[model samples]
Target: MSFILFLRQLGLSLAEIKAILTSDYSEQTLLLNKKQALQEEIARLQALEQTIDDQLQQVNQQDTLQVDQPIHLRVLQRLPFAQDFDLSVVETIDWQPDWMLRQLYYVINETDYAICMATPAVSDYQIDAGCYVTTTIEAASGAEFDSALAAITTHQTLPLIGIEMRGTFLSPGKHLAVKILGNRKE
Candidate 1:
């Protein structure tokens, strides 16, 4: 044992020291177990959706998010709604890391991705000119925001032109977009 820990536990019995060593990890392990439980619940619900959604003639195919595909995510609420969306690509920005919380995020078939806010009249440099993984966008402000929500809620497909998904590597107003690739089911 390190001198610091040895001295710290000098007064404790050997059994007590062992407990301290292992007990430190118990709380974190329990919390991580909850993640698995949540995942299993999600799988159960998805199975239920698939089994009961037989009204459609065939199983719904996955939507391949193509390069430069512009997806719309609303910033109206703190939560951007996370789900498979009837089994499409992960289009919504649902969760963010600590420092990154409360900011706009994006994802792809993602492959989850991110984007950023842009000016109304965007410069050509900020338009369809970067690598496929990143882009910028002008999120709907004022009345347009409501319209976007309605359209996305009803149609499940909203074509947003010009605006790129905010990227962290880009300039100010750029939002981070992530795309996880590989390990796709056949």
Candidate 2:
């Protein structure tokens, strides 16, 4: 076949072939650049996500706390008033080394109190108030303080149920029954 005829038979119109090759190369270059950009973006996003996950893990580890058991404590004070408080159980952890302390505290009326009740009170009917394990727990402010105060205010204040006033100078009432605090096991 003549060279010109052979070219025609091969389906090559010079200008058309050149145009197709140029466009194909251009598309390929564009696709490669897009792939690189996408890879960079994906890497950046992954790094950001990893950083966020690490922060979350740190926070969870720092604040992770639980209550091991319930603690019941009683306090006798000179304050002449009937009051009962219930506080949220924050940290139920072993005290320092061996003993376990179940912390219960409340916050209310600007007063905060904490009680580290002993796990399994020594006496079922009576909790030894003077025991080292059953001491008054107090807080500064914030969540801890609020919790402590709440514990003391939630319980009902029983009006003078039974009381004994002494001396011939006993003003008016013969008997006064103040509110007594009681605990319901959780």
Angstrom error at residue 86, model 2: 50
- lDDT per residue for candidate 2 within 1-186, as digits (tens), equals 464454455455877545645665565654576578778777667655644553453334322212234334332111212233223232333234322111222211223233232334442223323212111223433455335434544553321111011111222443221112233233
For candidate 1, lDDT tens digit of each residue in 1-186?
683365244444666556657666464564466567678777667644633442121123222223343323443122233332221332353333321222233222112223333223432212232233212223334244334444443533322222222233333652322222212123
Candidate 1 has an lDDT of 0.35
Over 4 Å off in model 2, which ranges? Answer: 1-25, 62-186
What is the TM-score of candidate 2?
0.21
Global lDDT of each model? 0.35, 0.34
Instruction: Find the candidate with the highest TM-score and give its number.
Output: 2
Residue 45 in candidate 2, Cα distance off native in Å: 0.4
TM per prediction: 0.20, 0.21
